[model samples]
Target: MIFKYRKGDELIEQTVVKPYDSVFGGQFDSWNVGKKLSNLTTCSNFFVDIISPSSPDDAPPLATLHFPVYTDQNAHCHVDYLRQFFKIADFCTSGDACKEKIWSTSYPDPKSDIFVGYDEDTQTLI
Candidate 1:
């Protein structure tokens, strides 16, 4: 299926290899895999592309690291890990600019502790 979140953005047509599945993510999801029955998962081929930080957005990824995606034993993917991974990238979780660095930059006034170590629950550094 072809999907693109924004207009004027490139469209990505992904073949449904696993037909029915969702990117449930390993962390921050409403569901838990800690259960003995829930822990059961099947392996699927997944990958992340690493690109040079200096490279342009249009540039091809430098390396593709294939990772294992776990699904339920029932041939249905309960969660999508890639979504979880990318969503994490959309925010900041740091303390000191001179200390903590991410792909990692200090944004919006250069580390005024803006979203430092983003505590979503309390929304505070503490």
Candidate 2:
């Protein structure tokens, strides 16, 4: 989710990052699900874990980007911290990859170019 581009951790590339993000493992899922009111504020965690440069395949992640898995304002801070990395390992998208491809948001951000609020009413995401 974090990119080297100007946008920082907030990824805007819908194509380059879309097709390559997701996983389904019972073991991994349980551990990553996080705890309630614990350090793991989210019920579920989704992020790209970054490994050290020139490091081995099994090295722990140096940083990560939990861009889309925050429960509240506090978790938002954690997401931001992890989004400032320069390098990352494999993928971790939970279900983001299936979002836009399946359907679009009828109520997009007002600042976004694709905004389709209630006032528009003319077009629904399809």
Candidate 3:
């Protein structure tokens, strides 16, 4: 999963290599589906919960990402906020024993490296 933030006028993008099983429940599917929207000029934002994606007994859990776009502006805002929160937690906490695995986004794959659009309506990534 790729998360974006605003860095001045440019879009700063990051990638969550491991699936966020605890949050979003359907992360893998989201990422797969996102592959289509990844190249789009715009994307949508939605809510995501933060929790450990792996455990001692259940390590590297799988999840499918599902983003439901609402017509209501308030709902969009709320989900966007939650998504931002999850992005932060994932980046700062990802580790062998952590909940998420976020990275600086390496090259090779256009979806995550350059095309990086997943679910942000404004698309103001930085």
Candidate 4:
């Protein structure tokens, strides 16, 4: 789904796909409908929430990425933020453990890599 936020207007655009389980509720077997008006751009600052039916006790975790259009430094900052947000430690120094196995195997000298770290006490990504 896509939503755009705009100035002055309070509504936002929203699109939903069918044949998928509804996160809110109700058995929507057919294509449902809804609408709103807003001025937000395609790529703008916004918040998103994703939920699952199985666990209802806690709010779902969220990941956000912000990229500036005109600066390489900003781009690098976003990348590094993502790396740190995912709790990846020392991607530059780590060897095979930091590389994505599927990507490394599929591509010829792929430039990007991924790493995952966990908090032992909570068994969650830190």
- TM-score (all chains, Cα) for each model: 0.24, 0.20, 0.16, 0.25
lDDT of each model, Cα atoms only? 0.42, 0.41, 0.40, 0.36
Candidate topping TM-score: 4
Off by over 4 Å in 1: 1-44, 71-126
Give per-residue CA lDDT, model 1, range 1-126, as digits (tens): 111111123221222122234574332112222452355454344444444556777877666545333545634553465554445534445556524444554533445646557687987763
Worst 10 residues of 2 by lDDT: 24-33
* lDDT per residue (tens digit) for residues 1-126 in model 4: 222222223333333333445676654322122222132223233333322334454644232223222233235456544554466533333445536443344333523331355668878654
Question: For model 4, what is the alpha-carbon lDDT of residue 70?
Answer: 20
For model 1, the run of ten residues with the poorest summed lDDT? 1-10
Least well predicted 10-residue stretch by lDDT in candidate 4: 31-40
Name model 2 segments beyond 4 Å from true.
1-44, 69-126
lDDT of 3 at 122: 71
Candidate 4, residue 31: the lDDT equals 18
Model 3, residue 25: C-alpha shift (Å): 19
Cα lDDT, model 3, residue 101: 32
lDDT of 2 at 101: 40
Tens digit of per-residue lDDT, candidate 2, span 17-45: 22233473222212232353245443343
lDDT-better candidate, 1 vs 4:
1
- Sort by lDDT, best first: what order? 1, 2, 3, 4
CA-only RMSD, every prediction: 17.1, 16.5, 21.3, 15.8
The RMSD (Cα, Å) of candidate 4 is 15.8
